[model samples]
Target: MAPMGIRLSPLGLAVFCLLGLGVLYHLYSGFLAGRLALFVLGDQAERAGPGGPDAAPGSLPEGTVDLRELLAVSVLAAVKGGEEVKRVRESNALNEKAKGKTREGAEEKMTSGDVLSNRKMFYLLKDAFPSVQINTEEHIDAPDKEAISWDRSIPEDIKKIIQPKKVPAESVTVWIDPLDATQEYTEDLRQYVTTMVCVAVNGEPVIGVIHKPFSAYTVWAMVNGGSNVKARSSYNEKTPRIIVSRSHAGKVEQVARQTFGNKTVIIPAGGAGYKVLALLEVSDKKQEKADVYIHVTYIKKWDICAGNAVLKALGGHMTTLTGEEISYTGSDGNDGGLLASINVNHKALVDKLPDLEKASHK
Candidate 1:
């Protein structure tokens, strides 16, 4: 009465177990492949959200792009550009020419170093993040082929400070000054020369890299993400050593003297990058170190964006002479003049300056 069930042979039971195992293995493999696809094609996958695959790269929801990866790529681009700058200088093949006139009617020079470095940096950045906006100093057609390969490795020091974070790709703007001190470079003042890169999100610079090719020195920072360099501990606020452009020092010198008094010690220097480095106490020469950098004339975003990011990382400020924060969104030139200070009261410094326009005319 209890024995109505038919029993399977041992061989049949073994085959049944093998078939079940095969099904499980297939499912496991499928799961892994899905994850791999997400990792490899993250940008495209994220972009293909509710808007479909044709959606703009920045149209994806905010906080979807990894900023850390962008920072690493920027550092690589800057260092590579620095290498190119050094090479052109060493070869004595600048082929320097007056590219155009600045806002103040000074002859703005462009050299082989600028063109070569711009090509090197631009291609690297564009290849890595095609969606991000890049503003370089020079305008050149994209090459038929990219010679530089992308490097994804982040610097060890940078890795220690920055954490995983994301921003909208559309909100990111990269500013590149392939050769910051071209005039200084032509004058054989290699110490002032630098290759710089900056990452500005929503018009706020969040990352900066300044590489001095001659010295093989690099300092980088991410705003609120820490920096490899430290802010200068001691500031001569009493005498307040001020750094101004050697070529365009006349107006700033007059302003510095008027604001900080005749004893303010106006140190004429070349390169916005160098002046910012001076404020950070990154120079070996004592004279290069300063309390503030003043430029009472027109300036470019590419020239100061990296330095601005670095200063912001160190709890400093760079703004217009009127104490208004400069915007890097629309135009390349900032005619409000520049007022930058590190570990010092920026507003207080701005308050001391006489009317720059009146002072300049006088």
Candidate 2:
């Protein structure tokens, strides 16, 4: 023997080592399989109802994602996208990064985060509803012609929500704003940043979702369908609370003074969607919610579509100060200065501010 300690031959040692490695590999594989099983089984509720193996008879259609599923997907995409943007902003090199511009001449303020998030949502939606037309704020592409992937884990219950009749892609459209308050986002006003998505069929909004990334709250609805999330707001205050733009406070106070009088409390906020949410948000034990959201300057359609949908679902109203319904799908800019309120005082408030449309021209 070479030595007393080296009793076993090299072949024996090699065999022992191989056996140990095999055992380790087997344990690792088992762990991975267990994890995969957990992930697949965790969302049981999502897979329940008419789509599961025990699905209700005749509950499904040819193929589609319903309005409720669309709203849920929108919130999911927005929150995930907002998280990416937040991470990018947290980096020390945010301002040093270059920004892209849209066709409208406004700084696009797109980061890798935005592109990635937009693509992620697009793919997710496209996979769920292969024949639907979808559009986004970052890029102007012919949505009807875009390609889609077959990979998706969407539940059958979601697909059954689509109408039994197939709608052509050209007739339906979905608008997405991966990050709504790009300016406020760059300025570190995290609360103002939101991810928005709207679905319009034949130039009308059927569903909308607005998600506040930093706050992690989502407001979404189908047109005139009761809001899935209820927000308790006490509208008992003597003086009305008004929400105005933080970036452009031009003539807002003057308008408020003329419209609601000197007693009204004005709250400055960024992002049109957030301003609308402020109307429903109650602070502390008391209620300090806004009674109205008034903006005289022109705003993009993506900024208010989700807000309008949610407000409408709550029996609230958002219309031009001149009291006209704002149409979606055909245009990007909304020239009609908006007046939104959750209370029944919409007509009363509109009557109070009769000159807003004329004032906007000035």
Q: List TM-scores for all candidates, in order.
A: 0.81, 0.70
Cand. 2 Cα-lDDT? 0.67
CA lDDT of 70 in candidate 2? 56
Q: How far out, in Å, is residue 315 in model 2?
A: 0.6
lDDT score, candidate 1, position 259: 66
Error of 2 at 247 (Å): 3.0
When summed lDDT is taken over every stretch of 10 residues in candidate 2, the lowest stretch is 158-167
What are the lDDT figures for the candidates, one per model? Answer: 0.83, 0.67
Error of 2 at 121 (Å): 2.2
